[model samples]
Target: MINYRPKVFDEASKSHASKKLYAILLAFIVVMGIILILESIIPAIVSTKPMLEEMNENGYLENPDNFNFQESMKLAMKVSSSPSAMIPTLLSTIFGTVTAIFYCRCIEMRPVRSMGARKEGFFSHYITGIITGIILMSAITLLSVALGVNKIEICHGVNYKVIALYLLGFIVQGMSEEFIFRGYLMTTIGGAGYHTGIAVMISAVAFALAHAANPGFGVVPFINLTLFGVFAALHVVVFDNIWGICAIHSIWNFTQGNFYGISVSGSNNTESVFRTTAVSDKAFLTGGEFGIEGSIFTTLILSIGIASSIYLIYKRQQLQQKKQPSQE
Candidate 1:
């Protein structure tokens, strides 16, 4: 059975702010932080320690002292093989986002959007999302180059299936994120009496902070992700639908994992990325070995993508306005 929650009535198009909403959001942040910390620790306690000891005994990891923390951390992220990771990842995507949004709703109170006949087409969602991705990736890539940071490298023998899964994860993650941050969070805060700009800015910043635990998450990544959040909001403005944003995100990520063959947010998987060539070693230019999305080439590509998406939206809006019959 579905649980329904009704928001309080407000005469204005905007709704009243609820103290409860902010409280719930705060708690969500705290819990999420705790979980990330625990995940980091558990790997060392169980798998990492055991593997290192075995390696020491067998000489595979010959030098215990020389055991590179970064390399071990990479293995730790791969705690479970590709197939197994899906279970927890899916659960987290569904349960985590739902739980957070529900809690937020509890404070603000509202109905979930109708699950009835869907309004938007999948292609619209996918294409818009791809445009967003291209813009973002290209932007970071170019910025890195301008700043003397080239973070790209070509690799052979990519893992396609694993890449698919990774991209799927991004889709799930991106959709859930957009819903919570843009849909729920944006409405909650905006209705609660905050300016639209404030609400959007806060939500974007929050979204970036949420990923503070990712592998290559740094100032650059954080700023990039925040920009991503803003870009997502713009998507909502243009389409008033989630379809495009989700599609673009999924494709963008898949392209990275399958075509580029690098760690998505710093975690490796069983996937074959066709392109494997580093542009440089500077973090500023090449994302400093973090990922190509942070490279100069990606930056240039993103700039074009962003302009294209915007132009499409504007053109679409004008056409729709023109198509409307004149009222007598």
Candidate 2:
């Protein structure tokens, strides 16, 4: 049986403020450096000479002189959206993992596992997270359909290999964000004597800010993203592990982009099983170009998720307290 003593939380909450602050600064510098390096190398690798030649031959560049840097960059981004882009995206997760390790070892003087990477209960929690994510996303899609804000068309002859690649890519994307926000920032801040509530809020806000530059981002999307952050943090607290939240994050994106054939945070995957069309007059419900994640339905579902996490945590605490007397 898993112990519900909050041991990881206690250890993380004991981090020194000065050390945590310094670690945060160092992590920021390292992550930014890594991103800049990868941004330069990955684009060049993905947008090779042959690819450009093919584009020109295919009449994609009818006016070569008109193909400015912006257009070239757009082509690069399009190419990078494919499954072949996995390598570059995976590199991002590596950077995040390295930053977390640096802070845990050098600053907090604790094992990396203390950041909620414990192996116990990982599989079960991860499966639960996957189910939860699918249900939430399905709910949002259904709501949109019912409201006449979106329509879905079935896509045939889907390539399973591409779907597999997207799954892997989304897994990397999801876990990377979780490691940075819930694992590193939340633990470091909470460990530095800040209340758990404060840490969760700070981390959630940071998560939202991190995606502020995405195309088509707006007030509703920003609010919904922040709510997602809060829900993820609460999920970690309830399960006392990061595995579940990682699964949820990964499967959520994969389902949105691959299964439902909808854009995820303003980015669309060319290989999808369904084609979702947004009603022109219902941007608020359909989330328009920003995808279903920006819809009000998302906010409602995530709020319920947050509340559910809180309830589960409370119930677990009570059960643990009851078990204490039995042991005595």
Candidate 3:
């Protein structure tokens, strides 16, 4: 059974955070602004050199009139694959975590633990989360391969160094997102006297919409993203801490992109351990440009996860009630 500690909400209630939707909206703006500024800094500084080199090779720089949009896009994709170019993009996500923490601690006057940064049981929770993430992502990839939705082949001469860099980046990237969405936004909303249900749903939808601009994002992908957000939120509430979900998010992305060689959320392919090549023509099964995260198998796994989380929450609630004496 899961532990249902409502410490976040209880603390939020005592704080002077904005009421209802304002907390969410304000938090959204602040977090987004901070993240955008931080994410742009390194990329803008370092990525320009690669782009210039690509442009020079393609003669786009020498002859501005002959600039080809298609070729430029390909150049961008190629540059994005370079570890030196992309690692900074991933690492910059730390600002998201910092931004959320700052807003909560300073702006809202809430303690860090109230944002689900509880120090107790962090290691065990994080390890369990890592295993759970691997299992979940592996299930999607293996099922796709077994059913002929996709095929996998060993990526020879794989750059383990590059993949390690990606792992580091994903650690920050995933934790940043969870801290912003689940820790800050969701908790803030719930702390403002709103129903936890409302807080969860709103944060989940916001998370989905945040990715609407990704390539190959469609109706089904939107649904899946929202479901993922819900699953992450439930995990947060069930465990009453962000460490597990943070690890899960990091492992999920790392396993998808670097371990199984699948595209991560419509992003371009990077160095991976195994290359998952598409064999089927069906976009629904193989997820087209969105990668395995958009596949039907993902839907199934996330649904099971959500159901399990709900069951755990219910069981925890029952256990909590039993622990309390009757109020007759």
lDDT of 2 by residue, 3-71 (tens): 233455677765543545566656655754665465447545755764677578657678777777777
Worst 10-residue stretch by lDDT in candidate 1?
2-11
Compared with the true structure, model 3 gives a TM-score of 0.94
TM-score of 2: 0.84
In the range 178-245, model 1's lDDT, one tens digit per residue, is 66666665545555555545655677788778767666778777666666666665555455555676
lDDT of 3 by residue, 1-328 (tens): 3335467877766666668587468667767877778877987787788899889988888898887777777787778767888898899889889988988888888898888998899999999999999999999999999998899999999989889999999999999999988998888887877776777888899889888877789988888899999999999888888999999999999999999988899888889999999999988898889988888999999999999998988888998788787753
CA lDDT of every candidate: 0.54, 0.76, 0.87
lDDT of 3: 0.87
Please give the ranking of all candidate structures by TM-score, highest first, separated by commas: 3, 2, 1
TM-score of each: 0.66, 0.84, 0.94
Rank candidates by lDDT, best first. Answer: 3, 2, 1
Clashes of each: 40, 1, 0
Worst 10 residues of 2 by lDDT: 1-10
TM-score, structure 1 vs. true: 0.66
- Candidates 1 and 3, the one with greater lDDT: 3
